[model samples]
Target: MNDAIHSSKAPEPVGLYPHARRVGNLLFLSGVGPRQRGSRDIPGVTLNAQGEIVDYDIATQCRSVFDNVRNILEECGSSWERLVDVTVFLTNMKADFKTYNAIYADYFRDNQPARTTVEVLSLPTPIAIELKCIATID
Candidate 1:
């Protein structure tokens, strides 16, 4: 029942915050972005060299966001199987929701977690997607 922080080898935290925090048996993860470690390059489904939305393509951004989430989960001594809930924030829901759901299904094939998706005017970056979750460490 102690409050502690956890990190994994998937990617380093952008700041002082740990990838997740554990209280009791539950772990709370921060919102995850699509920036891969050591490389400022953001994977794009359609955008060119510049960072742009590129006609609402979501697969690449969705996958990268999930990869970041997976990394954080692994570092926190958890996995997708232990996930209890997730909250997804998107800049454009009308165009990207279906694509995001399709890509998201690839990861949550089992132990489907409770989820909420919301449409937002913008995200931290121009990226189309971001995800945050809660999990249990077994």
Candidate 2:
């Protein structure tokens, strides 16, 4: 059986989908972004009048994305240590990868889950980064 999960403390998803879904012991998270809970504000990001990204601090976005992922995992009965895999999406890998990787090391030092980071032209929102994750819940 599959169970859809929502997190009140985490940012609402940009689209019409649950934050995560549980199939038996495995939990699959939707692509999680750095938007803060209850608002569209993205940390370290500046949007122009047209809502296009003006500038962004990848390090800040990386931390916020990590925190958002963790909140969803904890809300859905999993945790950072329980994560089995992560897929990262960045709008600018060349400019952000080194900073993102350094911060990622800080967060995943003890529990390093399998990870893949990629560059994308854009995301649904003006945010610079997002994360998709899989974890086991006991």
Best-fitting candidate, measured by TM-score? 2
Question: What tens digits encode model 1's per-residue C-alpha lDDT throughout 2-119?
Answer: 5656454444555667777788789998778776776666666455566665654578878888888887888777887899999999988888888888888888887799999999
lDDT score for residue 51 of model 2:
94
RMSD (CA, angstroms), candidate 1: 2.6
List runs of model 1 lying over 4 Å from the truth: 1-16, 45-56
Per-residue lDDT for 47-137 in model 2, tens only? 9999988889998989999999999999898999999999999999999999999999999999999999999999999988999999999
* TM-scores of the candidates in the order shown: 0.83, 0.98
lDDT of 1: 0.78
| Candidate 2: worst-modelled 10 consecutive residues by lDDT | 6-15
